[model samples]
Target: MKKLFLGFCLLVGFTTIAQTVADPPFMQDTADKYFFEEAAENVDLLQIASDRNKAIKVLSSHGLLLPHEKIIRQDVQYRPLLDMKLVALTEYQGQFVYLTNKAVLSNAWAGKLYINHNIKTPKAMGIGPDFLTMIAGENDFAIFKNNQEVWRSSINNLNPISVQHDLNSGQFLILTATGLYQVDSDLKTVKKVFEATNLTAFGFYGDTIVLGTTNGIQILDRNTFTITKMDQKLPWTEITSVKNIRGSLWFGSTKGAFKLRDDGKYDYYASKRWLVDDQVVDLAEGPDGSVLVLTQKGMSKIDFSPMTLAQKADYFQEIQRLRHIRYGFTSDLAMKTPGDISTGYFHDTDNDGLWTSMYLAGELFRYAVTKSEDAKENAYEAFEAMERLTALPGLKGFPARSFERDGYEVGLHANGFSEEWREKYEKENGRIWQLSNDELWRWKSTTSSDESCGHFFVYALFAELAPDKAWRDRAIHQIKIEMDHIMDNDWHLVDWNGKPTAWGKWNPDYVNGFPINVGDRRLNSTLILSFLQTAYHFTKDKKYKKAAENLIKKHGYDENANRPASVIGFVEGEDLSNTWNHSDDEMYFLTIPSFVNYSFSEEQKEAHFNAVKSHWEVERSEKNPLWNYLFALSGGKNIDSEESAWWLREFPMDLIDWKIDNEHRKDLTKIAPNFRNQTYTEVLPGDERTLHLHNGAYRNNGGSDGNREYAPYIYLLPYWAGRYVDAISAPQPE
Candidate 1:
């Protein structure tokens, strides 16, 4: 019986496929789940080092030191330094030792105590096989074994900079401002191996010594001692620290931290996406094969956990349920304290119904595929919230943009726009606030085409796929009233003042008013045609089809709808046609499902298919799963499922709106600004940038500060819809 039920679920998941394509292969395996956490308190970080157990030890100014352990969370263990000003930090034999102004100290099980070191005024410390090496003064270096100084020597007065032990050669390597030196295990003589100026850091890669200078990298062969200067191909020069972790060379520079990949390319980690600040001071191997980056503000741990796409979805689902739901609708979370999730509150937006519909539609798809009762409840709750919008305004078919309880100041007057702009706006569109019939709420007016697109799309899905009869009838009735409103009012969503809303126009005079280059001309035609067809498909009414036919034949909408995105260039002196309208893209994609699915004939369906294909061809570089999955519904073979999976896998688990700036990176290839506002030739991974909304251009750089946390509707919709259409598989067995 269990196997039979599983087979039925798979059948329902694949029921919406017009044609089957190979699912994304990466969905069958574990992918990287990336997230970051900051230190509890900000401090001026000085040095960071890791032990064999991967516990990180951090030293700060004024004798502040903390040991960090990674278990369920990045836990900071505060151990007192006994008021001794620590100068450097390193771990030896699973114990953290510190070089202080008074003496060398060890943080063992007892407490902070002296290490009985004979060296005076230690400047730096390094770890060896059985001994601890320290730079004693400007020209002296000392070696200690069993907490006692064994050997002390004066170099050729080169002015020591730092010290480290070479594990491959079993020698204590010394770095000076002018040259590099090494001492054997006997601690007899220190010999200068290579000469270099402005040396900042050094590490070992196999049998060669890799030196980091302010200008570039220098390599020296241990056998021959021949120096080779390599060209600098880093994001920024001025290397501050270097480490060889798990056979990979990681570098810390003035601008950011990056790793030298085996492919000879550097994996750059910059901006707030990966660190608290761009100025990375130190780097260390962290727990679970992560990296601990120390900056002026604090420490940031970048962790990569193995997870599947379904696991990522489930994680985001919990986040949304915790902070994004408000009044039974998906809402944005505004943080009272910037970047602090604990001080967040859900706020309403103008597209509340629209966003809720999207989330609700995804839940409907999830319920169809998995038959989960939780998903059904989520869809029903969101539907009720959206349904309340239509009835709140006291107008049968007119839906409010959003609603808030009484006594809240909102709308145009409260938005702080200039008086001249507000006056002009009022002249074009009427007053945008109305009191609910119950006198206990206020509803926002001037509903746009975006809301209508969301309404019809989700209502049609529920009408066709809902498991319960009563729910399906409710969905059908809602679609009828909304379509009747547009048709009865001559293709305009009439507002409370008996006038059409600003963006709710679909009449011939309105859609045909703009030039062919304007996006609204094509977008409005597609929307109304889709709306009429969807109404006819479900209601079986002859008038809706007749209205659609009249618009297509008499209004030249077919030619307009088929226009390519290539022709959407800037038109001189036309405000609406000056640039690409991304909002139009969102509305078009949402309406395409109904436009293609409920077509009057196969010929019309083919036209819709061509329309989607053209749009997808331009947006293929975005690698958006939602667009790809929607295109596959029209039987598109080249849906770019791999790119879609890339989008899903690269999405960061942290949804906070961190200010990400990639413009200053030298690794990016910049392009001339075009009509689409595409500044770069290639899009950065989702983790490297901000969370992009469907209406946002992915090619754009820079984003808002951490003041808002977006919901998971943007991700949930595409993921679940792809599962329903066979573009993506369920989580595979590990």
Candidate 2:
């Protein structure tokens, strides 16, 4: 019996070892990189206090967690001395380094520092910037800022405050422009560590420090204040930088990057074969320990990972970085797949709203940076997919909004049209609605037609920003076709091809159709004014002027008698029976001033601008996050100071448990799990709650309205809020 028990235990041990050695999907040598994002959050912080050690062992093998006192909803909430200006200010060990000027800090001794406004009470010890700006130790932070000897610390913030914290409790070799110094609790005060004439930069692994100076490389020991030289030919140029990786010293020069192993040998690791000027701007370690090299030309990758990690980055880089790779998209600049379109690659996330937003913003980011390879590559791929969309014909002169996964036209309002699909579409469910001839040019019931489409404006914005003039021409040509060809003397824009059926209409506050008796004011606004204003933003065309001017003059901006000094309603006309209002009233309020500012006619400009501001003052609640985002985008005078953080407050405190909400309907409260693939009623709303985080859009297990990534608002809100203005241009997507 004892032997039998021993045999069982032996089998268990073997199984555990086997799991540890389980082969990854790809080989190690060819691996490029792997993402370790949110790795810490995936750890079970909800584990029992008794099992804290087990929790630590299981959590955070990669990426980083920004050192929090407690965990909320499995996400770390680090209480810092400064208020968290951004959601992601971090602490490595115990020594906290503020990413934003005002960041949250916490200590076992002091509680928390709250941020009332932009002003901070205790001026950050290192208010400006840090050279070796990484959080290295548990309670220790290393900043090579002023003098080589002036590193700062927060040893007082720790719980036990031991001299032996794995990361924080370590020696700091400060590198100032003047000289170097070392501060230690072991010593009475900060003492002179070493002296170097023109020390450039340095990185610390532990007590050992590698310093870059005008004289070359000097290695210093913390306990003894002794300096030694290991490599006589250290790569130290005017542009050289230092880092310690994999327990060995490394350096980056204007020409290339090199590494030193424990076996007393240095090798040239990173260099550009396709070089222009060969000047390295920055070098940092990526998620999977790949050598990240930033050069004057663009970012480059090094393929050397551990055999267990990836000896060659070819496979790993391809597998891990989904951001750079396209799926089901054959057309690529590098190489074309058999079924790829003529333009280029297809999609990283297909054509979902989330993917569209990311692609749009990312494209803007690329253009803002001006010709970075990452930006170019991403834009190239997006343009290709969008271009293919143009190939799909329009219904009643407007392109269909979306397609089925099979690449067939499934537009509810796109049966007969000025443009037709490449492949013929047959009515499968008999749910297809065909438009009537009377609706043509009248802008009524757009079961499918593109007279005054708001979404067309979004499409227009992207089309205008496209690098290809041909693509831009096509987008503009479409607008011309609608404005010149379809817009008849009656002044209505829609030519409804779909048959009038008893389908429910949508409003900002109501999801499904309320009652047939209630009227719709939004559809007209979305179709008419949205398109004109968007065209103005894009082409600055005088042709769009005719349609927008007519609407403003006739409707009183809402359907009242005369053009009033004050705008009555944004969405002017609709059947009161449908009970629909244009939720996008904000679009008019935002774009009016912009249009006015751009206009040569001063009277028209002020009239529009003044009307927008006056209406906004009355309409905007100033409290809702969505309106706050729009208010900021409007670039108005007498703005609210706290409006910026108001947007941040809604940034989904727990990204994991992100609740999908429609807010428009109570019936479709939450989507159900196991829902995917089936689009346009093919998949039930109950099916949308699958744990899918494709790109950043996610809907998991019985959700409604496909919140966030699954929703359309997340990307638009941030873009409108001017979040990327610091990184790119403001007021509009490029």
Candidate 3:
């Protein structure tokens, strides 16, 4: 069952990231990979000079540091001066380790095994010539040639022995496309275990191998070759790579990452970013056995030290006390800090910590649900956190923007690090968009430029609970800024930034990153329409009604690229990323039909709907991995029974949660004619296919180019699909 859910993995391969590819139109991939590059530079520096912890500190060369979590930080210090930039870095004990495929071998290591001499598939002198097979062990090693094998050197004189594969865990987990055979240490003959039918990753916990596919996490008992499964309903799940730091059993999927716990259920922390490109590269115990991070993001220590278990436990206890956790919104995460960049963030762009702190607290809040005593305590903890968080700090000009209670950054629109970026943008060529360049930047400021859509959710919770006029006014004002994008005299939704050159107008780099850019009208328009619709529902804000009507009236169905549905969004660039384009159309599907049906705009609605009905083929086209009913929901609601049912039943139904669509980009249909095969998209490799590879994260623009932004519809849809979920019960405006 789990294996069946992994059917979509290979079908989502995206653009070239590390290798050579065609040139981009203009805006270069300015994303700073310095941390990765730096780590790679120190490859082969993994000499065991003494304590494993100290070696790790030395190897890090300051590229990473340790934090305290469940795993305690090792007390160690070392010199620094890393040469090669890192692609992958991990600290085990005191020794710092790095990976560089192009490395010259101060000593060589491939996969995880260190080689005395470079491994060689020595050429055969005769037909089917016998080759040397070297096996690794704790101290000793063995070599096998032909059918004959011998053990030599070090501890136990032990060699890797073949063991039966656990079907639950699946056989043959593919790492680097190389098949890894599982075996037990206490064995003699090399026997063939269950050859994996087709899978990517597996988690080995003592005798149990956990397979993580879209369906759920399946536990395979190696001895019995039996499969037991545990599935949590969600969009995705993942199993982490091995971490030898604390002899731990760690894994992560749609549910989250976990460390081996005595209680059997692993201690967990879940986040889309914590996993790899939708794959868990490593479930590593860092310098400190604190929070185990299941990702490839290069950093020695993930600083979760401040979050103590007692504090978290108390937090959990409080969360369990409440039924629903309502939160207020602020613009703290959206800021660019003050004084540096050229682009202006509409909100709290600097203190990213403000949002994440709440997000983390939210995690604890969620965990409290299972324990009732914890529930009582968790509610109080969350409330305290929320009130304490109300006063956002770090605003530059507005004193009112400063949350007085906590002294954190606060504001509604056009503020934060982006403002700082706007101040220094031309000079720097681009902006970090977040705050403070410190390596452990979890509590800092940031965004993907396309971040405005979710801005109100945070604040709306606040409005729902407290109903402050100030919060209401601020939310309303920020939304109006989106309407300002339309032409005053004509009212057509022109390119918001008004870039003239084909590329400049759309600014792929500016609009398609991650959180999303406000400069995007199709997106902002959809959200704006929805916001107004929502506001009118709550406040009867006629202003929103007026704006939605005028905006829809001025743009009409045929104004964009000739097709009404295609007109859902406009790009000033020569081309659009898969993520951006697909999500753009979602806005139309989500709002236009409902808006028309409800507001007595039948004639125009039918016309626009007809445009959409005509272009429906293009919107659902499979040539790009970016279109679907999901986008429709992002803009409005995914109330379709078929789509909803499919989502619920097949929603990450297994431990190995991979959307394995075997068809190549050209072979798949179900999408649109212009789309089924997107040779038309001229985007960088990493830029176009990023969304498809996320571990249950937002598919912002689909790829780095922003094609899969429609991905969020998968989660956001049920909220507005008129379903009977508790948080919001409003139906589409009529």
TM-score (all chains, Cα) for each model:
0.88, 0.37, 0.33
* Stretches > 4 Å off in candidate 1: 1-43, 50-56, 67-80, 101-121, 132-136, 144-151, 155-159, 177-179, 185-192, 195-198, 206-210, 213-235, 261-268, 271-273, 409-420, 423-431
Residue range 1-734, candidate 1, lDDT tens digits: 11111211232232244233333323211112112244345446677766666666667664444443321122235545545567888766667777876567665646534565545556776777655554455677777666667777886564666788877677787887788888764747778887878898888887777888887677788666688557475666788888887687988888778888676767677666566677778887766767777766656676656677787788788888888888888988889897678899876677888899989988988897898999999999998888888888877788888888876724443222466866786676655667788888888887888899999988888876678889988887888898999888998999888888777999999889888888888888889888888888778999999999999899988778878766676778888886677777888888877777677887887787688778778878777788887776545666777778777777776777777766666556778867877677777777667666787756445566778888988888888877777667777765
- In candidate 3, what residue range of length 10 has the lowest lDDT sum? 1-10
lDDT of 1 at 213: 81
* Per-residue lDDT of candidate 2, residues 1-734 (tens digit): 11111111232221000001111222111112112233344332110010111111111212123212321122244543223333222223323333333333323224333222222222222222322232223333433323232343543222111111113435434455445555553342544456656666566657866666545567766455478554445433443567655465667655555566455434443222211123554454533444544444333444443221111112222322342333212211211332121323332222232234334443443353344565446555554544333333344343323323332323334323423331222232232332323322111123222212323533554453456677667766655554442344233333233432222221222311322222233233324454565555456776676666665565433222112323332232434432212233433433332333333354554454454555456434332323333333333434332333332222321112223322222112233432221112211111112322221222223322212222222323333233322211222211
After TM-score superposition, the amount by which residue 157's alpha carbon in candidate 3 deviates from its true location, in angstroms, is 18
lDDT for 31 in candidate 2 is 16
TM-score of 1: 0.88
- What's the lDDT of the predicted structure labeled candidate 1? 0.74
Backbone clashes in candidate 2 total 75
Which candidate gets the maximum TM-score versus the true structure? 1
Write model 3 residue lDDT over 100-182, tens digit each, in one string: 32221122123333323221211101011122233333333344334244433332322222112333333222221122343
* Global Cα lDDT for candidate 3: 0.31
Q: Report the C-alpha displacement of residue 211, candidate 2, in angstroms.
A: 54
